[model samples]
Target: MNILQLSNRLGYPPKDGGAIGIYNYTKAYHDLGHDVTVLAMNTKKHFYSLSQLPDSYKSLAKINAINVDSSVSVLGALMNLFSTESYHISRFISKDYDEELKALLQNKEYDIVHLDGLHLSPYVETIRQHSKAKVAMRAHNVEYMIWERVAMNGSIWPKSAYLKLLAKRLKKYEAQRLNVYDMLVAITPEDSKIFKEDGCNIPVTVCPAGLDLDQYKVDKTKIESMSLFHLGALDWVPNQQGIKWFLSEVWPKVNSKFPELKFYIAGRNMPKNLLNMNLQNVEVVGEVESAIDFMNSKSIMLVPLLSGSGMRIKIIEGLALEKSIVTTSIGAEGINYEDGKNLLIANNPDEFVTQIERLIADREMVNDLGANARKLIENEYSNFKLVESLVEEYKKMIV
Candidate 1:
């Protein structure tokens, strides 16, 4: 099968959930000997160019990444609303991208067109109406849910109101666009429920995210120092909020109990506020070369997420690396794990402190949980297992 995938960002570095999803799927399709072509946005506001395709990658399709014009930033999104429909559409739609896609579909025959993430949903209608291929939307998350979580978790009401309006528009558009695709591929059944609740009467498949277990392995050196690690894109509100809450409320208690234990925060775009936070035991390391490296070194990974959507890839990666994970009920959502078996569940600051204390004090318990978590990941979230399921879904869509 000839597969064409459109993504909003680069998937190689695996910086965030969306990138990780694209990278794994592309690798899977390529390994199956299917012709795969990728069109990634490279949303970072910088000039990016591609040369030779990776040896693992089959074919080099169109690469349309360009500097995000300041005129097309969030301010631009607002401005485009008042401008011509072309500009309004262009705000979210990349002109070069659309032209490249049209030419590709017109020139070559593709069995499947996998539009990755709702970021590319704007182009779904155009492809469906004009192209001759089976179209599917792999929604990373209901975008509105992210904004809604941010709004509810935010402390200030005025800021929340603005975000609330943005969420409203995005939610409405997300629901309306579901009809444009033949199938909606979600990372979890919970996401499918959201689509159905929103009146999207389309075929939905649960394609959970998987990790590269080979690339990530358990490091015994990581266990030498008792450390708690949190990793994700710090620019994300949920992560930022989680850290803020942890540092303010939870960290004090944890630090007082174990003054020597280290808490490492690592991710891209670390806010100055978080970086400058003068906590005794907290160290905010901004953007490590490899998150897996940090995870391997840590004794425990903390997922104190207050509000967010979708399956937390961080949790999957941590578990895959065999790290003892201490996460909130919300943080551990989507992953099927018994509270005391695979991972520790903590709801509030008190629970978080208690779990951390138990994990730090009891080596046997932490090892048990880590071993179980690793086994669960090997059995469930391995790339081989997930890709097989995804391929089956793709076959169903084409047939």
Candidate 2:
């Protein structure tokens, strides 16, 4: 089957969740002998040259990228209030991207035209005009739900009000585009239910991010005995909010309790405030050469997400690397994880501290949790299995 995947960014060097999701699925589909071509946005926020990708990866599919500056501006955000369109979605609407997509569609026929994220929904009409392919929208997250959660978690009322405004418009935009796709490939079953509840007339499937286990190898020897870490895209509001909460409320207490234990934070776009922090034993690792290597080196994984939707790919990756993880309910939302059995789930600051301490004190429990977590990922999140199942679903839509 021929598959044309439209992405908002490049998935190679899958440092973050969004890139990991896009890259793994494409690789898995290609591995299954499917012709998969990705036309990526290559946004300035997450830019990468195609030349940087390995030759083996380049051979996987006809990977093409277009420069798209989907950055936010103070002027643009204020002007958005005068219009009915969603500011969040409108930022990705590029004429160049549309024209490139149009040209690609006209030149090469595809059985399926996959919209990787909700941000790409604006290009649906251009796709409709040029391609006879069955269009499928990969609902990475409920965009409005994420904004709502961010607003709820926010402290400043003025900023929260603006976020609420974005949420309102985003919700309306989601409802308006409900039936535009042939199917909605949701990242979680809960996400699928939410789409249906919000008047999604089309078919929605639960297709969580699948991991290629071969690419993820656990090194128990590398893990530091008294180390704790949090890794994710820091530029994202939910991540930044969660980190601030963890640092201000939770980190101090944890540090006081276990003065010997070290906390390492790693991810892209580390804020200036976090970088200038003068905390004890807290290493603000802005970005790393390898995410897996960083995860393997840490004894415990910390995901104190206050607000965000969709599956947390980092948790899955962490679990795969056999890192005993302590995350909030929001962090472990989509994964079929047994709390306390696989990974510990802690909601508030106290609970987070307790869980982290528990893992630190009990070496046996940590081993057990990591073992179970790895097993859960092995059984449930197989990339090859997920790709084959999704392809079968796509066949139905095309037929």
Candidate 3:
């Protein structure tokens, strides 16, 4: 099959979860003996040079990237206040991108044209006009729901009110655009259900993010049993909020009990405010060269997400590496994980303290949980198995 994957940003050098999600699937389809081409908008924030990618990756997919400035401005925000269009979605609309896409569709016939996320939905009509390909919108998350949750958790009046307005506009935009595609590939069954409830008439399927298992194999001997770590894109509002909550409420209690324990935090785009917080035993390492290496060095992974949607890719990678993890119910959503068996789930400060303490005290329990976590990934979330099923689905869709 000739597959063309459209993305809002370059997926190579998969630094964050979104990048990893896009790159892994593209690689999977290519490895399955399909001709895959990835055309992405290289935004200023997550830009990548196509020439910098390794030859092995280049051989897997015919990747191309075009510059598109997606930065926000004060004037643009004010203008959007009076318009029906979503500021979030509108920012991603570019004439150059549309022309590039139109040219691609005109030049080559494709069996499937997969839109990577909600941001790329604006070009559905363009794809329809130029190509006979089956259009599939890969719904990463109900985009509006993330903002809604953020607004609900926010405190400041004016800022929260503005966020509520954005959420309302985004919800309407998302609902109206649901049936525009031939199919919807949701990242989770939970998200599929929500899309149905929102009146999405298109066929929906669950395709949770899959990982290359061999790359994440566990070597327990290398792990520091005393170290705990939190790794995610800290510039995201939810990560910042969750980390703040952990430091203010949960971390203090845990530190009082185990003062010698060190909690390392690492990720791209660490906010200045979060970097300045003076929390005891909390080390803010801005970013790491390799995610797998960082995970292998830590004994327990912390995913203290207060409000976010979709599966946490880091959680999947952590489990795959056989690292004992403690996360909130929101953090562990979409993944089929059992509490107390594969991982520990905690919602409040008290529960977090209890779960962390349990892992700290019992090495055997941690080992058992980590093993169970890796077993779950091998059986259910293997990249090869998931992508094989996805290829079958593509064949069915084309027919």
Error of 2 at 178 (Å): 1.2
lDDT computed for candidate 3: 0.90
What is each predicted model's overall lDDT from 0 to 1?
0.77, 0.91, 0.90
Model 2: how large is the Cα RMSD against the reference? 1.0
After superposition on all C-alphas, the RMSD of every candidate to the true structure, in Å, is 2.8, 1.0, 1.1
TM-scores, one per candidate: 0.92, 0.98, 0.98
In the range 1-94, model 1's lDDT, one tens digit per residue, is 8888887665665566656877888877776777887877755532234554454443434344433332346676566456533331244477
User: Which portions of model 1 show Cα errors greater than 4 Å?
Assistant: 45-48, 52-74, 77-91
- For candidate 2, the TM-score is 0.98
Alpha-carbon error at 78 in model 2, in Å? 1.4
| Candidate 1 lowest-lDDT run of ten | 83-92
lDDT of 2 by residue, 348-385 (tens): 98999999889878999988998999999899999889
Total residue pair clashes for candidate 3: 0
Per-residue lDDT of model 3, residues 1-399, tens digit only = 999999999888887899989989888998899999888999998988877889877888888888999887899999999998999999999999999999889989999999999999999999999999999889888889888888887448988998899999999999999999988999999999999999999889888988988778676667777699999998788898888889888988999999999999999999997788778888999889998888998999999988889888999999999889999999999999899999999999999999999998898999899899999999899887897887788788888
At residue 222, what lDDT does model 2 achieve? 65
lDDT of 2: 0.91
Instruction: List residue ranges in candidate 2 displaced over 4 A.
Output: none
